[model samples]
Target chain A: MASRMRIRAKAADGVTEVKALMSHPMETGQRKDAEGNPIPAHYITEVTALHNDKVVLQAYWGAAVSQNPFLHFRFKGGAEGDTVTIKWVDNKGESQSDDTKI
Target chain B: MNHHRRTFLKLGGAAFGAVATAALWPLRAIAAAVRPNAAFEATALDGAYKQLGGTPAESADIDLSTPDIAENGAVVPVSVTSKLPGTEAIYILIEKNPNPLAAGFMIPEGTEPFVSVRVKVAQTCNVIAVVKAGGKLYSAAKETKVTLGGCGG
Candidate 1:
């Protein structure tokens, strides 16, 4: 579905820092269009991060989160060439996964 | 000009009333449930802690990183890192939001206990980070000054 996610991973001082930027509307269902029509709630509900196929971080989010959410974290046991994967699922059952090399 | 001032005052009064009522609304029906729904709906921090399975939280092992002054409330960078071993989960809470449970993260084994993200802040309020590790809860809080209002304000 052409999910737009920018991911970066870097290794330093025995810690691998992973940062990701996911693109989504993140509508809270409380906003109204210019014509005053209510926008339905559409937001990323779950986000999971993996380090070389092992789960590192799993997050549950709500609509109160800001648009185009940014996620960052650090984990041990990753080298400069290791791979980190990030996946997100929205409230509407849509999902996306992306990977980056440290 | 007097009529305009009176109209503005009336609107202002009505807005204040709405805010006061919304803040005081008791949504405790979910408290009896076994799930974590009440934690999100609870307006007060202590009440939310109770809803989330209260265990005395210590602040020594937790670190909450945030700018002292947030120029934009729509996206304020917040991060939580715990030095405690066997950390299982971390939760972010904003004290004054309509629904304060901003985000919760489950930290799996072999992973470091850390999480960072941008969250919306309704106003100048304390941002609390709760960590569950080794079957116990720990927390740390920091106040962020927001110059701009977010969260439907």
Candidate 2:
């Protein structure tokens, strides 16, 4: 998807705090072209974050969502230096993934 | 001859018309530029709005501190403090962004509503701070300006 994504995480106070930013047009079909044509809806529909293979959080998004989504979430019991993986898939089946360790 | 005076008047009128058009150039350009669905964007907020379930926000009891104007859109400083009891969550939203949701925090009980951070705003937008406490939402907003183009993903 040629996505430009950045992830930052911190495991403190027994919580794995995660901040994620990803790139996607997230076009809602209701939008129009230069000629006033309806631009089809295209957006990342699902995103999941994992801490050492255990799913920490997952969400389902919709066209109402905006482009270049930015998300922040945290989980209990994650430790420093643990690997955190995040993945997202768009409505068109396009996908992107990345990982960062705290 | 009177015709010469009339001819001069016609030239003067043409020059005056040109100057008038030049003075109004910016307004004309803005009028032609897209005005964005300001109303729709104003009402449609971002983030998992339902996850932090609460009553629709009312503009009372939340002390939202921010600049009257944000000189930079890429990283505007934002802070939220509240008088609401047992404040549990705070969210930042940009009303003019394609998606109004900028950031959401699930502040654990006892976690303060005093949160500070930088948020990216693509254009001139309203920054909404929603504080959830005691199962209700109290909110406030400030208008921030993004002078440079930071809207790019």
**lDDT of the candidates, in the order given:** 0.82, 0.65
Any runs in candidate 2 off by more than 4 Å, and if so which? A2-4, A12-17, A28-36, A53-67, A72-77, A89-97, B1-125, B146-153
Q: Which portions of model 1 show Cα errors greater than 4 Å?
A: A1-3, B1-38, B41-47, B55-58
Clash-forming residue pairs, model 1: none
Q: Please tell me which predicted candidate would have the highest TM-score against the true structure.
A: 1
Worst 10 residues of 1 chain A by lDDT: A25-34
Worst 10 residues of 2 chain B by lDDT: B32-41
TM-score, first chain, each model: 0.95, 0.94
**Which stretch of 10 consecutive residues in model 2 chain A shows the poorest summed lDDT?**
A57-66
The model with the greatest DockQ is 1
All candidates' TM-scores? Answer: 0.78, 0.49
Q: Note the DockQ of each predicted structure.
A: 0.38, 0.04
**Residue A91 in candidate 2, Cα distance off native in Å:** 4.5
Task: For residue A13, give model 2's deviation from the true position in Å.
Answer: 5.7
